[model samples]
Target: MARPTFRELTAQALSSVEHGYDLLAPKFDHTPYRTPDRVLNATVRVLRPYGPFGTGLDLCCGTGAGARVLRAVCRKRMTGLDFSAGMLDRARSAAPDGTWVRGNALALPFAPGSFDLVVSFGAHGHFLPRERPRLFAAVRTALRPGGRFAFPLAAPARPGTPAYWSLLAFDTAMRVRNAVWRPPFVMYYRTWPLTDVRRELRAAGFGVTLHPLSELGVRPDGSPRCRLVLATRLPEHSG
Candidate 1:
């Protein structure tokens, strides 16, 4: 796949989240925004002990990166859901064996206790911090007791570092762009901090655990560069 041109990206940046993804769907894999294979592979390695699940879902499964990971860990059905039709079309074509559905993440179009494993990749930035509770509640409702909701989160860059400034600049620019733009694109690099995310998951009826992805390497500070958040849904009577 060829990379999207600057004009194409500019157009996408100006469009609504769904429309922007639809426009970028064809060449999304060629971009750095796509989840890298190492991340997917490492996720598979970590999930193997917890899975071989009956059914799996890839929430916000842009172009099927996470769905492909499910294929390795899940024994039965594999489904991918995204709000963008164009992205779903590409995902369906690339992985025809899996099912693809178009729906909003906030209100997933699945029955309660429908899946045993759910994974998402590179789609968290599309959601606002306030919207996380509703989003996580929906995921919890869709999962059976003991089912898991998993996603990767990287360590925050240290303050005053070049990487830190770069992220701060990108988020600041996005805030400015959204202030002037309609149907704001909600992509913020610094929003999904691990502490807040774990608290929200616990409140959403999940027992949260962090598994270090050492294959991705560690920071100079000796912390893993990335960790997979495994939030298992608890039974109704359990906390």
Candidate 2:
């Protein structure tokens, strides 16, 4: 299938959140912005060796993309959680077998040590840097001791490429929009840098590791353009 044009996708993205996604939901699967199946398959491949996890959760599981990944890795039960009713509606249609919940990431409804594994895809930009520790801690409290929370993080855009400039413009525009608009549409491409993310995860009681998705290939600098960040809660905390 031919991918949707960038203009069409951008048009939907710029509208109000619910209305924008309600419009995009129908064609979202055909867009590059939808977590690529290659990335999903690669994540499943890496997670397979370690899992057979009992219960799994997909946070901000837009259209159930990460739920599909968890379905392959988890053994018993799986769930997809998101705040967007439009997104959840699409996700429910895609994965009828998995549980779906609508709620905020900062205060997940599950009790402490509830899930064995939790994963999210392409949802971090919706959160600001300061909100990360709370988000990570919430995920940690929802997981069992030694439970793993994982997600893919791509390398930063290179300084002068069109991709880089495009992202900068988009983020700048979002800032301007938020200044003039109400209930800000919180998305920024450059805010959640990986180094800052790692520190926040550690502060949230997780020991983190990085695994290169070598299948995605390397950048001009010979570094992997895509990698997974696996953050596991420690079994015990030191005083």
Candidate 3:
């Protein structure tokens, strides 16, 4: 069968929330918006050195993109969690071998130290900056002592590029949508800056490190275009 056109995919991705993804669910695997296999491979490569983990959790595991990665890195079991039922349904179908739980990232249903490793992909934009502390805390509680939470962060778009303008416009529109609409969608591409994220991670008890995803290549300024943030929880301080 032929691939769905970009127009069809965009129409589904941008239209009604559930219907949009419901339409895109099947072809989501074929889209570039899905984290590329190369990125996933690199994540596994970087995480393998730290792993041989018992259980892993994929936060906001949209369409099971990172769940597949977690399955490879995790030695025992993998679970994918997300808030959207539609997305979870698709992810469950795609990854029937893995566990799928539908829940908000803010209030993860897992107990403290339940997982040995936690990872997320392409979903941070769904969270606001203020929510990072709670989100990080939840993830921290979800992992065992010294367990790591990792994700890839792309370089900020250059100021003059179309990507930059598009992100600005999208954020503006989302702000407008939230102002006028009830139960906002709340996704913004520009809100989660890396510097702020690092501070938030530290505040939430993670000792963070950045590893360059060198295969993605560097920017014109000689900095990595994409890098992974690996945040490891420190051993709990006993009073």
Candidate 4:
């Protein structure tokens, strides 16, 4: 895929999230926003020991990057769902063997106990903090007892660092843009803190654990640069 031009990205940034992704779909994999192969490979390697899962779902699966991970770990079947039809179209072509469905993450269209493993990649920024409870509840409802939900959460950049300042600037600019714009493009790097996420997952009936993605290496602080969050759905009877 060719990289989107400056003009193209500017157009996308101005459009609504769904319309923006639709416009960018053809060139999405070439964008930096696409989940890197290193991340996907690390996720697959770390998840292999837990799987050979019966069925899997890739929530908000954009262009099927997570589906590729699911393919390696899931035995029975894999499904990818996203709200953007254009993304689902690209995902279908990229991984024709897997099932692709168009749906919102806050209200997953699958039945209760539909999957044994659910994974998401690079789609959290699309959701707002207020929407997380409903989003997690939907995922929990879609997973069977003992099913797992996994996603990578990177350690936040230290204050005063270039990366930290850059992310802060970008988020601030987005807040200003959304303040004046209609149908905001909600992608903030700092909103989904790991602490809040863990609390919410436990509240939603998932027992959460963190596995360091050591392959991605550690930060200067000796913390893993990224950790994979594995949230298992607790049985109805268990705490």
Candidate 5:
């Protein structure tokens, strides 16, 4: 499918994030915003040793990209949750076998320990830094004792590189646009640094670890190009 036109993007941008996603739902898979299959596949590879999980929750499961990973790893059930009704509508169709729920990530509707694993992809930019605590805590709460919450994180673009400048410019534009606009769109490419995210996850009581995704290849510096953040909830009887 062709990308959303300039008019479509403009309209989406001017509206609230939920409504914007609602408008973009149909074309989301074709857009760069959708999580890539390679990223999803790499994450699945990284999570395999940790899983054979009983049930899984795909937090912010827009278009169900992460559902593929959950379906591959989870034994009992897979659920896709998102705040955008339209996105959930698409995800329901995309991953027909999975349960789809419409609700905010920060305010999960499910009971505590509802899932054995929780995974999210390509949705962090939608959340502000201040929201991480609530989001992480909610995910932690949603997991069963000793359950895992994991997501992929790539190294940030190096300074002075085209990718770096592009992200900087994009974030700057978003900040300016939000300052002048109402119902601000909250996406930012550079907001999720691994250090900050690890701190937030730790604060939320997750025993966090990083799994290097070798399948995704290595960086020029020999580091894995992407790493999966594996944050595990403590078992009830653990010290």
Candidate 6:
């Protein structure tokens, strides 16, 4: 966030979401928009047991943080796909060894069963709830039979807590901004509940499973702070 100056942030806020990302791409790594290294590291460790995966895909790879997970786990080719040309340029430059694809997540440009593993991070907020089914279907289609799609989801903060209020305020602000703005920047903090997401994934043909990311620890109630959603594309003959 600090990477973009006030003028730059204002410009992005006033622009459409896609163009906003394009504007922010060069300095995205220095901003909070970039996925944290810790989250990426934790994912690598958590997924190591589930993988020794062949080909891998990183969906909506902003600047290739999740590509590290693909690189670590996959034995074969690694690919990063994103809608933003500026972001894809940065990803390609940063991770030269991997393939960089510029395309929409809702309609992934790949053959069916193209990848053994697929991972996305911090991109769910951009998709409205109604769009999730299509988005997930694309991911499901891109994966091989028995391929796994994974991402981290945090437990909702308790009501009246600072985190809860902060997210509420952000969502409210976004709603108001969209209502008044010419082109809306669709970002929501609280829309993607785990139960709803799981249902959507299941509807899209994934067998959903949850793995608590122990490295991030649990909240006071002992619920994990975050858990990884491991959704597998079932094989044709599997019971």
* C-alpha TM-score for every candidate: 0.98, 0.92, 0.90, 0.98, 0.96, 0.96
Regarding lDDT, does 1 or 5 come out ahead?
1
Q: How much lDDT does each candidate structure score?
A: 0.94, 0.86, 0.85, 0.92, 0.90, 0.90
Residue 184 Cα positional deviation in candidate 4, in Å, after optimal superposition: 1.0
Per-residue alpha-carbon lDDT of model 6 for 1-239, expressed as tens digits?
45889899889888898899899998889877788888888899889998899999999998888888998999999999988889989998989999999888999999999999999999988999999999988888899889999999989989999999999999999999999997999889898999999988887888999988888889998889999999999765542
Candidate 5 C-alpha lDDT tens digits along 30-90? 8988888898888888888887999999999988999889988999989989989999999
Of the candidates numbered 2 and 3, which has the greater TM-score value? 2
**How displaced is residue 3 in candidate 6, in Å?**
1.5
- Prediction RMSDs, each to the true structure: 0.8, 2.2, 2.5, 0.9, 1.4, 1.6
**Once superposed on the true structure, which residue ranges of model 4 sit more than 4 Å away at CA?**
none
User: Which candidate would rank higher by lDDT, 3 or 5?
Assistant: 5
User: Could you give candidate 1's per-residue lDDT for residues 1-239 as a string of tens digits?
Assistant: 57999999999999999999999999998999989999999999999998788899999999998876899999999999999999999999999999999999999999999999999999888899999999999999999999999999999999999999999999999999999989898888899999999999999999999999999999997899999999999988875
Deviation from native of the Cα of residue 22 in model 3, angstroms: 4.6
Relative to the true structure, candidate 1 reaches a TM of 0.98
Question: For every model in order, what is the number of clashing pairs?
Answer: 0, 0, 0, 0, 0, 2
- Model 5 clash pairs are none
Q: Provide the lowest-lDDT 10-residue window in model 2.
A: 12-21
lDDT of 2 by residue, 1-239 (tens): 46657786767656766566666776777876799888999898878877889999999887888887887889888988888787889899988999999888999998789899999999888898889988998999999998999999999999999999999999999999878876467878898788999988887888989999998999998999999999989866530
**For candidate 4, lDDT tens digit of each residue in 1-239?**
57999999989999999999999999999999999999999999889998889999999898998987998999988999998999999999999999999988998888999999999998888889998989889999999999999999999999999999999999999999999998899889998999999999999999999999998999987999999999999997764
- Candidate 2 lDDT score relative to the true structure: 0.86
lDDT, residue 108, candidate 6: 93
Local lDDT at 143 for model 1: 96
Please tell me which model should have the higher lDDT, number 2 or number 4.
4
Q: Is candidate 1 or candidate 6 better by lDDT?
A: 1
